[model samples]
Target: MPVRFVIGREKPGQVSEVAQLISQTLEQERRQRELLEQHYAQYDADDDETGEYATDEEDEDMGPVLPGGDMAIEVFDLPENDDMFSPSDVDTSKLAHKFKELQIKHAVTEAEIQKLKTKLQAAENEKVRWELEKTQLQQNIEENKERMMKLESYWIEAQTLCHTVNEHLKETQSQYQALEKKYNKAKKLIKDFQQKELDFIKRQEAERKKIEDLEKAHLAEVQGLQARIRDLEAEVFRLMKQNGSQVNNNNNIFERQTSFGEVSRGDPVENLDTKQVSCLDGLSQDFNEAVPETERLDSKALKTRAQLSVKNKRQRPSRTRLYDSISSTDGEDSLERKGSLEKEFKQGQEAERERSY
Candidate 1:
């Protein structure tokens, strides 16, 4: 009878180095078993009319060769004829012994394979754990880099702000210095101008006082001259009465008139006082006349009386008013005042002539 056996072929995931080695060994054992079965079948077909049996030497030669040496064969089956013996029985015995040794080796290999499988599963689990740790570490590194980028941007902005502030401070300092210099210059200029104005005011006050004194002296001189003229006129009248001559009397009167004219023309001070008094009278009269036209009789009368009091008793500052304002005069206007004063004098003379007429 022929025999066949099934061989196991595991899936790719379940296969390993040890499993492949076991498969190859099983394949070799199956081929050897098939060869032994073929020899047994051929030996059974041969016709030996004499009941012959295999000798010890042939049994030894027919036995399968093993790695160590030739082993003794076992008797497992009883021969069909008790007296008949065959060489196939010896091959069967040797194969059965090999099968027992292979079974024992297969059991030891299965236990070692089970231990190896357990170790492989642990190594795979450890590899998976290491991969997870690597992924987490990468995420941490990326997040740290992002944070560093944000921090670097902040540092750059801070540096810019610091630079701007420094520039602004420098500019402000320069501006403050310039403004301070200007302020100091202006202050100095104002102080000098004030001193000059004060000096000018002092000079004006001295001139005004001097004019007042001169006016008083001229008034007393005019009074004395008037007395002297009265005495001379009295003496002339007595002489004319004594002579009783028309021509001589006319000569004396002509001489007196000529002397008065010479005195009035030569004394410019007297003419100035006369014109000044007349100008004040004209101003008072004009104001009185205009007041009546513009106001009620009672208001006009009061205003007129007040003006008359001022004109009669107070010293006037008409000459002072004639001076150009110091504040308005740029030295050029002050220089032009002389020509203007001459024209004003001419106008005053014309007005005085009209008054005499």
Candidate 2:
């Protein structure tokens, strides 16, 4: 890509170089044309000067004469010496010969002028071609400059975009690094948490097993003690029954002794007629009676603890209803917030559209 751009850029420079070359060639052509024009002008001026000299020579060839055309009268106006001739006797032959020479020189100069004119015309034509080339070169230069400006602008914009992309990539890389660190830390924490959870579960299982064993042993001991108590209660009832039978036999013996004493008192009544007086006198003074009364008063207080076992046979729905009501309220509030946000977003979009328009 850089090579392409360099190539593209070099094209404009090449165009500029060509323009410079064309300009230089045009300048050289112009200089040559000017020199040719100057040389042509000088040749034309020399031709004009030579023509003026020939015209003067022609005027001289037409010598001054008398009003009446008489060559003899014109020669008589001489001084005594012929060598010191009069104006009329001035030499016309040499003047005529010089005029012919001036005519020949003028013809040669005119021919040179004509040749110079031809060369000047050719130079002018070359100059015209060079001018056309110069104009085209100027156009090419302008076009190249415009293209160069466009390419430079494009390069600058591309560089800016590349810089922005690089910056964004750097930021993304930094964010990735940060996220990687966070992920590693989170992973370590998760591993530690899992290990601790495993240890906790193991400890809980061990404790549960220990408690179950203790419960089983305690239950067995309680059952054994209950059986022993029942046996002791049966032995106590048997000893009470044996003691009751012995008490009944002793009561019967006491009753017999009382009856025998009553029979002995009846026989003594017949033999005692004679001694009736005496007995009556003794009995009158010896009447003895004894009565024993026993009374017992007892007060007792007893404290007993009675336990009543009550169980709930059914679950209540009211507790579930309370939870449902709370959750429904939360859900409704969340929906309302969502609606509000959506409305706000729509309003913002509409406002943005209005601003854009």
Candidate 3:
């Protein structure tokens, strides 16, 4: 009966109903057993009182009687007293105990169902919260990726700018080095020019002193020659006067001889005096002509020396032109080097840009 009750209660909404039906069936069975015992006692009394029919065939063949009918006894159905056999009519003590047990079991089952429902609800809520958190996390990751990409682009731009700056710095440094070298060379050239100028000035001073000395020597020589010419002039004048006196005495002697031819033959002295006067006149004229020629030669020598000194002063080259030439060359070379450096730097920059792309 317990197995049949368990099998019946397997269907939906049947466990509680099956428990009530089993209790009612058990009560009916107990009432039927009591009724059968009463019927058997009456039958035994009737058979003992009928002593004349002790051997009657009817008595021997009589069967046990049922409460309602044969069908009610076989199937354990209620008799016509259906109200008496109802659950309410059964003993209250046993039914109440069974009902209490079923109530406790149902309460425990319902409490468990409530606990399961609460657990399922908590699990669903947690799942929703986790899904929201995951979405937010995915958005944050995308934002970080975008920021990283921007940073990478910025880094590349910064690197390019840095490379350009470095190239400019290198070019500037090279230019500065070249300028330094040129400046040093210019300084040395200036020093050399200064030294050459100093040497030239010293030379000029020496030449000037030499010229002064030559002028002094020439002046002294001129003075000596003039003194000598004056002395010769004085001597020639004295000889001329003596020749005149002798010539006049010879003329007087000749006039006496002509006037008195009978005089002595010693009159030859007049002819001799006349020849001495002619020789002295010729010598005086040659001395005067030679003095002018000597003076002219001394003047020519002094004029020649002055002209040489003037020429020396005019022939020296200006220092400015030499320095200008040197500076012009330096400027040209500097410009060329600057152009080459710029071209090389530009080419390198273009190549780097191409490689990056």
Top lDDT model? 3
lDDT of 1 by residue, 1-357 (tens): 443333456676787444554566577656655765685556545423432344456645744632243232221222378332243443443344445656755664465455545644564575577679889999999999999999999999999999999999999999999999999999999999999989978975675565456544544544454454345445544543443353345346546765687545676655646755675466435433432222211233234334544755854535422231232242234325434643554575456444433
lDDT of 2 by residue, 179-257 (tens): 9999999999999999999998897678556544644454454345335434533443343344234334433543464
Model 3 Cα RMSD, 1 decimal: 34.5
Relative to the true structure, candidate 2 reaches a TM of 0.32
lDDT (Cα, tens digit) per residue for candidate 3, span 150-247? 99999999999999999999999999999999999999999999999999999878876776676566555545654664565565456545645654
Q: Which residue ranges in model 2 land beyond 4 Å of their true spot?
A: 1-140, 240-357
Model 1 bad stretches (over 4 Å): 1-144, 234-357
TM per candidate: 0.31, 0.32, 0.40
Worst-scoring 10-residue span by lDDT in model 1: 290-299
Error of 2 at 259 (Å): 12
Candidate numbers sorted by lDDT from highest down:
3, 1, 2
Could you tell me the C-alpha RMSD of candidate 2 in Å?
Answer: 37.5
Supply candidate 1's per-residue lDDT for 182.
97
Order of candidates by TM-score, top first?
3, 2, 1
Candidate 3 TM-score versus the reference: 0.40
